[model samples]
Target: MPFALYLLALAVFVMGTSEFMLAGLLPAIAADLEVTVGTAGLLTSAFAAGMVVGAPATAAFARRWPPRLTLVACLFVFAGCHVAGALTPAFPILLATRVVAALANAGFLAVALSTATALVPPGRKGRALAVVLSGTTIATVAGVPAGALLGTGLGWRATFWAVALLCVPAAFGISRRPAGADDGSAPDLADEVRQLGSPRLVLALLLAALVNGGTFAAFTFLAPVATGVAGLGEAWIAVVLVLFGAGSFLGVVIAGRLSDRRPGLVIGVGGPLLAAGWSALALTAAHPAVFLTLALTQGGLSFAVGSTLITRVLYAATGAPTMGGAYATAALNAGAAAGPALAAAVLATGAGVTAPVWVAVALTAAALAVKFAPWWTGSRRPDPIKRPRL
Candidate 1:
């Protein structure tokens, strides 16, 4: 892999930390801003909304800009948002900063995905994408935990400051790269937008959404499930989370090696196993040892399937190289939003915390059914890599 790819991953690590660290800081933010915890939670929703909108909007608006310039500008804006957020006293202002920061994060990811693939040969696109996405998994493993510790030791504002400082080095690294690193010409915006109407591409995006939605459905509520259902102590919560993150990092690495050659086999084998793991988790939630082991297994299978589905989306949207990343980003965020919301609804029904695990199982099963439907495998189906002209 190219050295620039590592730099891009570094930037992603900062952004991913900012995005997820809020989960551990909501209480401090709520108390500081004189708001209920539920109200402070809106900050997360705002960020996700921004990501869903920003990925395509920013990517389209900056399509004509130099790739390096777009990346650097997004990083500066992201860092600035953190600075402003750290200084703000009002909850509304902090919420606004989260939205703006997410927008910048989305733009950087959109451009970086295409740029990463551009740095490698066609056959290595999946591996390149995995290298870029590994930053996110690593963020889950290390950055988020460190952010939580920092927030606990200092104030939550300090976490924001730390993220901003981290962005400076990433911005400098990205800026030092030559402008010609991205070899592709700017895509035609009209053609790119039109490709959204492609059935094959749409299906691929849906698959990506389903895979991530299922994963987040369980992940967002893991803490409650571990304590209330599994009878684990508070300290064990972090341990299980770390184990899951470690599994996720391993999953992405394995997908990188296999996805380029056998995407079908990866998804086909991984999807069912992921669903089965979720089912087992729900059934055995009362057993702490079993629950902990299943958490790690599910994490690996979930990311393995999710990563492969994302690779498929890239191939399905081959006609729109620039917009392909935007579409994938949008789909993944949409799933992330929808999954947790649905799980919350299920909990509202007094179905217990384990209900979310069942929701994950259903979602994964639906993805498999959609993926292997007769129509999807029919003779009329087009090759994922060969997008027909719109």
Candidate 2:
């Protein structure tokens, strides 16, 4: 990919770290703000909720801004929110900061995905988007652990400050790019709205949501699954989590290569594989080795669906790439917000932590049905977003 793609990935890394690192800081934040751990956990939910609302709204609102400048503005706003988070005196203010920061993060991701795909040849757009999104996997592998370590040593505030510091370099890298003339043109809002009316596009968005919902429903309860079902020690949990992250990274690379040509194959087979992994976890939880192995496979197959789904949405909303990109983000975040709740509801019924795995299986089955629908298998709509061959 181009140097600019790497810069966009760096921005994604910075923002993704902000999103994932909050889990590790919850205890410290709760203690500092004199709130319960459950309340502190709402910060995570708040961020996801913000992204779900912000993605399409911000894309529509900033449709006329130059892409590079829009990205830079998002970075600065994200950094400012972190700074505010670090200095906030009360819990509500801190919660508000996370929501705003998530808005910036969502806006940046929508624009960055559109820009990255546009920078590449038409056939290479899936690979380009994979490169940009790899930052999230990398963050899971590296940044979140490092942020947790930093939070443990310094303070939660210090971790937020560190995230702010990381944003500076990404912003500078983006600012150096030359602005395009078409970047600031007023987008045809009417046309974009009409494009959103497509059933194919709406189904694609629902697929995105189902994919993430299945993955996260199982993931949110993983700690308990590890301890209660697998009988793993606390230290072993970290190792298992790392294994999952590595699997996710591998999944992205593999999917990037195969999706453009065999998107249908990937979605059709990958969904069932995901369901199977979760089902195996549910059935074989007593076998620690099997549970650990299944965890890695499940993580991989979950992320492996991303490239195909993104490409599908892009094709479905060919008239408005940015709007399509935003729709993807919104769907993913909506799933993120919903998954934990579904898992929690299961656990609330005294079904045990492993209940989530069953929930995951059911959700993945629904996604698989959607993927096999005739409309998705063959959309004859002409590509509206014309591209010059690179």
**Cα lDDT tens digits for candidate 1, 1-390:** 888888999999999989988999999999999999999999999999899999999999888777898899999999999999999999999999999999999999988887887788877878988889988988888999999999999999999999999999888988997744544476689999899988877888998898899999999999999999999999988887887888888898899888878887788889889999999999999999999998888888888888877877777777888888899899999999898889999999999889888899888899989888887667345564543211
lDDT of 2 at 162: 95
Give the C-alpha miss distance for residue 112 in model 1, angstroms.
Answer: 1.0
**CA error at residue 213 for candidate 1, angstroms:** 0.5
The RMSD (Cα, Å) of candidate 2 is: 2.7
What is the C-alpha lDDT profile of model 2 across 158-246, one tens digit per residue? Answer: 99999999999999988997633235765588888788788778877888888888888887778788998899998776666777777
Displacement of residue 334 (Cα, Å) in model 1 is 0.4
TM-score of each: 0.97, 0.94
Against the true structure, candidate 1 has what lDDT?
0.88
Write down the TM-score for model 1: 0.97
Candidate with the greatest TM-score versus the true structure:
1
